[model samples]
Target: MSLKVAVIGCGSIATHRHLPEYAANENVEITAVCDIVGERAEEAAAKYQAKAYTDYKTLLKEESIDAVSVCLPNYLHAPVSIDALNTGAHVLCEKPMATSIEEADKMIEAAERNGKKLMIGHNQRFVASHQKAKELIESGAIGKVYSFRTAFGHGGPEGWSADGKESWFFKKDEAFIGAMGDLGVHKADLARYLLQDEFVEVGAFVETSAKENTDVDDNATLILKSAKGTIGTLAASWAYTAKEDNSTIIYGEKATLRLEDDPTYSLVAQYANGETVKYELGAIQSNDEGGQTTTHVINHFIEAIQNNTVPLIDGIEGKKSLAIILGALESVKTKRIYSLEK
Candidate 1:
């Protein structure tokens, strides 16, 4: 049976990835789409051959929606996901599940109480290069992975959205944060996914240095300690002038894995026995692949639902990543090490 799917938020990601991918999948049907902007929802629904709604609650009440993709702003993620879970629909929420830990917990609680799957859109795990890195790490090529560094940043979203200033991404109340929420959480999430651990502590600093007159932070740097004793540095900024950059470097006892660097590869294994090899398998850049992050994301969720198992990026996983980012924000304010594990 085809899983009936409703997509909430018919913005860039929906138009480019979610609806299109669902439309291509024979196992799922995108039955509806919702957005606060009625025209945007209508346009998306028309293209995908689905119904349209301005209110997510209205879409939730519609019959036979087995699952939904909550692509709303960061602040609305928990409420919409919780409501969808309560409505007996599995939810695939976009990253940084919620602005606060408490909201994230409530979303998890709702999913548990309803016995529904709640997947987060930390899609980089499915990226080819990242998968390759995970394989190499698990195979011990990267040794113990004692430490790592990862970063993702861009020159802001002026080009993506038709109206840069009017985009909800700049609004603190709507988006919850700026570049950190927009890009940094993905790096943090990808780090956790690759390392197979949770960040326990974060000493961070964040400020709105680049985008003038914006309420949210446009630049952020974090020092994090993972549960596996891996201390890492991460930075996210919206001030980049040239191009988007997403890179990760791992320090293993034997070899080091570098992703998103030039030559587009992972798993450059170095051995103590005087052997150096480069695994030049390329990566799936998030902004590239036709701007298709949720394409791979929704496919994984469908596979999980079909197989009766867990998605690659689940809600609890989402909470873990978001906690690190939030901890960074807290650390910035307190100028102290924020403990997340406790």
Candidate 2:
């Protein structure tokens, strides 16, 4: 029984990650591709052998879709996702759940109202190296994790967005917050997932240092303190023109773990007792380097629907992570530590 899936907003994310992954998944049949840009939608449809739609509402009304991937701009995420949910389809929305907590709440409500699964596309959780690192941390191999520094940086979305420099990602109105929303949120989610704890306080400095003619910030540094007393820095930058830096360092009582930092190894463990071990999980997926082994996000989403189970990164989990980034933005605005409780 193949699940019929439709992709809304046939942008770079859909083209690069979702559509390809779904094409590979035998459990899903891509029934439709929709985008405001007719050509983009038609192009994807022609390649995937699915129907092309310029209006998502029309697609939702006509297509017999079991699930949909909402890859629209930051502002439209909530509205479009809610519409898809109301149309009786599970939604796998792209990151930074919504511009506001209120919007995220509505999205969750819509899914519950429709009895459909709503999974956020926080693909970092499904990365192979990240999965292995999580396993090691949970196994107590790191021994009482005390601190960490996780970062996601690249040349910027201009180099990757389907529309390039003219994309909505550069518009403050469409994007809301810049690199923090685009890249930092992923690290914020990853930190919460890896630490197995919620971030309680956030202090951040966000600014636009690179990419001219854009109001959005390109570089950001966030100081995060977990509920369990662990503190770390989460950085997001679009100024890494030299190369991408998607690395995390977790320091515990027994050892310090480095992820995606070294050219030779993906995971490196340096122990206090003078022992070094490297785990060869493989490279973290980068936009420039397109050989991503598999995200497994689509696979997990399909399985959850098939098994009547919850997706790993559900709406609530998505909201919690989104809250951290929101807090960071608040921190930048007010020049104060934004506490999650407030």
Candidate 3:
């Protein structure tokens, strides 16, 4: 049986990732599209042959979709996902799952109470290179990863968001945090996945030195220590005016892994034995190209719902990733290390 799906928030993510991917899934049907901007909703709905809604609550009350994608701004991710879960629909919420820990907790509770699947849209985990890196680490090919550095940066949301800089992305209240939430959250989740460890402590320096007249931060640097004693630096910036750089380097006792860092190879491994292996897994997903290279995220969500299996990135995992970013934010505010224990 095909799954009936509704897409909430017909913005850039919806347009570029969610909607097109859903349309391509033979086991899924786009039942509705909701966005505050009526025209945008209508456009997406018309293309998908689904109803359009200006208010998400009305969509939840009226549509009988089997699943919903919460693609709204960061602030709306929690509430909309909770509402969808309450309405007997599995939810696939966009990342940074919630603005605060309390909100993240409520989202988890609501999904449990409703007995629905709740998956976060941290698509980086689905990347081919990243998956291969995780496999190599698990198989002990890297031999005890000791330290790493990962960064995600672009020329700011103006180059990507549907509404440019004037969009909700620049609004502190709407986005909650800037580069840290928008880009860094993905890396935080990626780190945990690759290392199979949770970050227990974070020391950060988050600043709004770029993107004039915006209250939200445009650049951030974080020092993260995993519970297993792994140390790493995560840098997120909206100041990559020349090019996008989403790269990671993992140094281990035996070898080092480079992901999305080399021009010819998407993944490269250099060992102490003077042997190097280069892997070409194609380019990482970017704004320059859409609709083709997404990380099988939509398909995974459908498989989890249809098979009645827990998604790889569930509520607990999502919350753990969010805690790291939130910890960094607190670290910046207090000018001290933030502990994730509490």
Q: Global lDDT of each model? A: 0.83, 0.92, 0.92
lDDT of 2 by residue, 98-187 (tens): 999999999999999999999998989987778888988999988999999998998998889999999999999999888989999999
Task: In model 2, state the lDDT of residue 147.
Answer: 98
The reply for model 1, stretches above 4 Å from the true place, is 270-274, 292-295
> In candidate 1, residue 76 scores what lDDT?
89
lDDT for model 2, on a 0 to 1 scale?
Answer: 0.92
Model 1: ten consecutive residues of lowest lDDT: 286-295
Per-residue lDDT tens digits of candidate 3, residues 1-342? 999999999988999999999988999999999998999999999999999999988888887889999998899889889889988999999988999989999999999999999999999998888999999999999899899999999899998889996989999889999999999999999999999998889999988987987999899999999888999999999998888889999999999999999988999999989999999987788765654677688999999999999999999999999999999988988999998876
Q: Which 10 consecutive residues of model 2 have the lowest summed lDDT?
A: 284-293
Model 1 pairs in collision: none
- Candidate 2: the clashing residue pairs are none
TM-score of 2: 0.98
- The CA root-mean-square deviation of candidate 1, after full C-alpha superposition on the true structure, stands at 1.8
